[model samples]
Target: MFRQMFEEKYMRFPGGRAKAATFSYDDGVKADKRLAEIFAKYGIKGTFNLNSLLFDCERWHGRMDEEQTFLTFYNRPHEIAMHGARHIFLNKVPLPEAMNEILQNRVYLENRFGRIVRGLAYAYNGYNAEVLAALPALGVAYGRTTEDTRTFALPEDFLRWNPTCHHTDPALFEIAEEFVKRDPAGEFKHREPLLFFVWGHSYEFDDADNWQVCEKLCARLAESEGIWYATCIEICDYVKAYRSLIFSADGERVYNPSAIPVWLELRGRIYELPPATTVQFAKEL
Candidate 1:
């Protein structure tokens, strides 16, 4: 018999999906236009981390203009996150300087896009403990780092969010293959929602002459029916909502307090827990 009482309670993505995939591309560059097209073609969503000061800065031909940014991402199934106001290394500067960099970028993006900007991809993957602690007060919700963990695991800390791998990792397709085949319910030994997060700069494809990397990855993920394509912010928000669920002492009922709907797995059975509603399970622990 299954050890239902001892089994860990797991969660699923929207629509009761066990697997979810998200991409993060840094820098608002000319190549992002092509990258956005590839994502759109595959019906995938991702986040673009941009440095507002770099727009039309003319330091190089690759920098995108405000109009280019809007045309590529506006009204699209994607997100815009901060990469610092000037794309400087946050760890090297004073704490206030680092904060200003993020705040200026957030303000510009919010004013331009007419939406609250709260996510970040560190400029140069640099940050200190103080800067991380300062993010939430700055209205930031999650931050992405360049450290590639090479595993399908949810982050322990959203402020220091580490992705599964970079797009250019040699094991990119191998990892995607593993992600596509795994059935979360079947893995009784380890049952948790899987997140395949990939992070990179769009201009790297142009520099390395490897645009096929993005195309191939997108096509592979798009073919999978079980994977939920989501933006970085959406994933963070959903995870928060899932963690906010209140449970009864007997573990037979749960209430989702957040506005987002959640899917809970109890003893291998999946249950849809709607926002602000309580769900009672047939079996008690």
Candidate 2:
């Protein structure tokens, strides 16, 4: 029911349409040192997805440069989150194994970093419906996947069925359809998040051919309107804040944020949410 309603309300663009992009990386390797250095040099906040057990201060893949920066990365507070224990794909394994994989990594991080990590990215690019539905219970707020099907992703719970009715990245077939629709003979509308999410190995840059593609891609990703490069935790906060103002009703949906009554003040009379909620506080287009 919610998905149906979600599909109805947001199938069209809100207007001239707001835009955004999020760039992220996967697997913790020494290459990450250069990645972080480059991003930090440019003030671009790259989301570095990591596995808790991978950083061992030992050598692997030719270099003796295993990092102990798990302490630094997880503790930095900008962006990072769980990437499944041992980078295993939950969908490829049984439920208990999958859950344990995620949990072991999570606990490992918390124990080392002294704080909770509530985001995830399944390893091996594998995921199933059940793994998703179980996230809320496992202490994950959100996680990342490797799909780049060209769509602005909205969480399932927010759509009418979830609420936003945001369509999944229309992948191969949809891309073809969108191409036909846009020019009827031209190219796809690129109705996707302009901030295309791309990720893969750092060593890929080591190859002459692969490095050429990566060079052109990163060079062109610069956005003049400004791009807020962020990590997994930072992204989770934005999502939570955005969702706090959106809700669903019936098959039709409305953003009656102001209608939801709530106390205006929490602590020393500073924090508050007035009874008559309005879209005034919502993120602007």
Candidate 3:
């Protein structure tokens, strides 16, 4: 029985980490600079959503000039994602308008950052089925929503991905405590990869005068031994690569066709499969 358990095969995150935690913040507001600093202090990774049209736009408080600041202050480890060109409500708009919002913003962000912009967090978390369907063709791989699941499981559909919780979720501390207490090495019925995805707008911290909420959350989640701290796109790309792996008819050999390497847990050991490479494993009975 011990040998059989050792022979069991499953996908593991990079570095053999048992879980991942990522953050998503929307709107390219000035407050994001401070938020980014906080995240950096805690070694947290996140994706920042920006509306190309909103850059340098004046708000009731003052002009934000995010176009210049984003290029200067945003950390390289984090990602820049689209939040629509005009920050319009997609669910309320015509399909063409919605498409234009996403496509135009994607083009601008790609050109500005010199990185392929493939992730989106809906403006106002306002998207319908049509909006979701239009994303893939626009080169978007995942779209995050505002719906809070308050659980640590990976999303079934990336386009409609719901986060584990919002930063302000009344149960935020409680959930974080539970997440930290989970012992991945111990036997559990659910052996799938765990993800704690937190999403919110950086401006909210300024509004509520509660930056400490984020500070405490990050401090608690930082330096977790078995957790992978990653951006949304990084997590999505890795999972996609893992899912694209091919196995032989007898399941003794596996081929990785993706450009990114994939990790597999077999018999209590982690193995790395290089890109465009094949790995053969001993069959277990």
Candidate 4:
């Protein structure tokens, strides 16, 4: 039974998908319309971080022309998260001001977007221990930073969620190629879940005049049978749900407490644990 359990213990994403890919774009801007269209065309999903205070201002850091366009562009199949109220550097600001920056933006986003704002990509990728310590009380489930790991792996700390790469990374295509070649069923196998998280500002594509970079990257990863394309919040929620699962003393049964369904692989077979339910596994020795 011990050996069987060891062999069966594997994590599978929704629909038995072997890998997950998510994108994060900071700063709501006019260029997001084109970027959104490209992502939608390729069936890719991502999270857009917006500064509520800068939504429609005519200033240098202004966002889209109108709030309605922003809403319509990312209403479904994507997420809208906070990027601070004024897009200030949290690490440099006083703790009270930093807290206000996050909470104010959260409230405005929740009211305007009509969804709970549970995630944030730090403005200017600025954060510190104090900021991390205060996030949970403000209802933030996860926070993304600009630090790139250049690898496909789940975050060790959601509060400081380091992304895999920036969209403009010179080796973007090479990384995508490496991600695509990781076949779960091949001899060279990885038992753990793989997550490819890319972050950047959509305006960069326009500034660089290299929209093809994103187009090609998306094309290389789009419609992959074994890959689950998700928004950043979706990825965080799914992983949280998976970790919330409770196991019986003998490992014969399990309970899921989260509202989201959890997937797991047992003895090379995938099992879905529906939300708020328990399931008994067949004994194997």
Q: Specify the highest-TM-score model's number.
A: 1
For residues 231-278, what per-residue lDDT tens digits would candidate 4 score against the true structure? 999899999888888998887688999998889876555689999899
Give me the overall lDDT of model 3: 0.83
**For candidate 3, lDDT tens digit of each residue in 259-280?**
9889887655567999999999
**Highest lDDT: which candidate?**
1
Candidate 4 or 1, higher TM-score: 1
How far residue 34's Cα lies from its native spot in candidate 2, in Å, is 0.4
lDDT string, candidate 1, 93-166, tens digits = 99999999999999999998888889999988899899988889899999999999999999989998999999
TM-score of candidate 1 relative to the true fold? 0.95
Error of 4 at 98 (Å): 0.7
Q: Rate the local accuracy (lDDT) of all candidates.
A: 0.88, 0.48, 0.83, 0.83
Worst 10-residue lDDT window, candidate 1: 1-10
All candidates: TM-score: 0.95, 0.61, 0.92, 0.92
Misplaced by over 4 Å in model 1 are 1-7, 58-61
Over 4 Å off in model 4, which ranges? 1-5, 57-62, 68-74, 185-189
Window of ten residues with lowest summed lDDT in model 4: 1-10
Candidates 1 and 4, the one with greater lDDT: 1
